[model samples]
Target: MGLIELPAELRLNIYEYFLLRHTRIKGGNQPNNSHLALARVCRTIHIEATPLLHTYISLRTEHQISKFVYHVDASRCNVVTWADVANDGRVMLTPQSSPVSRLFLALRKMTGLKCLRVFDCKSGVRAPDGPRFHGRVILKSEEAMFPDDGAMARSTPIETYKLCVSPTTRSTLFTNIPPTHICTLRLSGDCIFPDASDFSSLRELILDAVTGNHFDRRALDSTFTSSRLETFCYRMGGMGSLELRDSHLESLRTGIGTTIRRLALVGCSRLTGNGLAALFDQLRNLTYLALDMITVRQLQVGFIRVLSPKLELFKFAITNVSYAQPLIAEEVMLCDEIESLIDRDQPPQSMHLKLRDEVLQSSGRWAKWETMVKHRGIDLRTGVWGTEELQ
Candidate 1:
């Protein structure tokens, strides 16, 4: 039978399967030939698969964007929904090659867009003048492309955002970010001074690699006003302080404002034992906490004594051996106890309760917990606290 001989539904299903299959093989990183190859075999396939192919176009050059816009027409890929533009020292931000502006026009065409991410490439494609994009656009700036294209006015209508860029970007985007639509946000790296307008609609925020200098006391006040915020992730990057002030910590504990449920810190070198203790005192609803590359010495002898009661999952990566040695020794004792508990019983029914209360409760070390949990015949998948709840 000819290519056109097949029913529309069957053809579309096959095209979708191939499109998804190719996307999986490429790790969902870029557009590949599979889309184009399918389009070439028949006119029917080309017409049907154009939207799917244009759904995600990773264009790096002005020429690429212009060509794509011309072929798909401004409306077809205008909502060029999701993009990953890399500023790898290749694209320079200029009036002609402004990446953000081109992206804005592409988004205008995409009336159905929901998420947009921008990475800088050395090629500077200027933001073209056209209809505006009305979706959630995340402009993660790795270069000096902020406050350039009248960005704030363009972004004022977006429903949500996740920004991690240089200082100037915060100033420009904050003014434009609509106060009503934002629900979840992630901000990292120092940007422009934040005002109350910046945090009006935020619900959940993940601040990673944030510099303390950027977060003045006033910004903290505005950003935390989101009573709806339920989760916050902070991945510390060699900044030698907890950077969280007393007011920020107090708001969480009082439950008068936002109640953060999950808090994570990775490689927070400056946060002292007291600093962490103070932060923990505020998270009344905290259920999961993960601290990576933190000095074990900071986890004082009475650390888990106060914190472990409410925590369901805790992860700590021991960076310093001197601090971990004592904990390792304690873990050895717990292991020996579990073995004894198992040997003492005919089938070791008591091992589950013993493992849960003794080993997992006290130590944050993942390796030790893995060893003890497996020894008790509990599958790690089913045994872990939140693994079952993951959708």
Candidate 2:
């Protein structure tokens, strides 16, 4: 029988398998060029696989975007669901090849898009020792910028995407972001974040690697705190001393401290022990908490108290944290106590506690806690130093 003689669903499955045979996913997805080649076999096969191939595209330049829209299938441009922009590790913001206007046009064509991921390859592509390069770009707003061509303006919209880009060129696409449809908005790196009031339907927000110099404190006032958010992941960066015990953190407490369900933080070393203690003491509705890379020289065993009655998951990463040896040892003891409490018919029996990082010191207490929580279904993960599988 001929290849087209197979059932439609089975043929589609086989075609997708072959189309993505070259795709790979590590820290992020690697580009695949097989879609271009597979389209050459026949018109029927090409027409069938065009939308499937465009669904998860990793385009990084204007040339690639134009070529994709012109050659692959012009009709499928709006049909794309997930798009990864600035993924080619290009150093220049608007390289000589990919114009920013062209990128804006490419985004305009994606009317049915559900997830859009943006990456600024400046740091990842070029190291500090590389040739010095400097440029800035910003996203501007316009009425007809998003969902252009009168295609599904309010009917179909993007849902959630953790976009990380350096927008300083004053382009007119930032205002086009769907405020009511977006559920998660993650801004990584220092850039002027949009007002929280804009995300009228936002559910979770991640301010990853954002710092103080460019941060707008007024944005996090009533407008931001009033958003219907359940998760907030704030992994801060920079050498500024403005992150600890400030009105910003207090503003969060005063606004939605009792409503946030999951909270994650990478507070700076400047946050004092008192500040750390004051953190968990404010929230009353958290079910999951993750804190990493913090320096708590005086964080005693009692400091890990969960003020939330609904606390279910408490994840702590101690790889880069600067804590005392006794504090680390007591952490193990506390895990043992948690297991004891859970085994004795505690309230959080169905809860999950995950302790991540390479925190196994010479005291040999790591293995003791590791084995104690194995049968109890609690997660006690000791991160490996490098990539050795246990040897």
Writing each residue's lDDT as its tens digit, candidate 2 over 1-391 gives 9778888888899877875454433343334455666667888878887668767666655567667656755577766787766532222333332223344556666767777666643222222233433442323322223323232354567777654543321222234454566777766544444544355667777765554443454535454544666777775545432353445566666664445788776654444434555656777677776665454564444435534556666555443253444356655655554445444422232343334333343355456655655666665544422211000
Residue-level lDDT of model 1, residues 260-339, one tens digit each, is 66666555544555545666665656666655433444333223333423455554443443444335444435345333
Candidate 1: stretches off by over 4 Å: 1-59, 78-80, 85-101, 125-157, 164-171, 198-200, 238-251, 254-258, 272-285, 296-298, 301-313, 321-391
Give the local distance difference test score of model 1.
0.47
* lDDT for position 42 in model 2: 87
Q: Could you tell me which residue pairs clash in candidate 2?
A: 137-167, 137-168, 137-169, 138-167, 138-168, 138-169, 140-171
TM-score of each: 0.57, 0.64
The per-residue C-alpha lDDT of model 2 at residue 138 equals: 25
Superposition error at 100 for model 2 (Å): 4.4
The most accurate candidate by lDDT is: 2
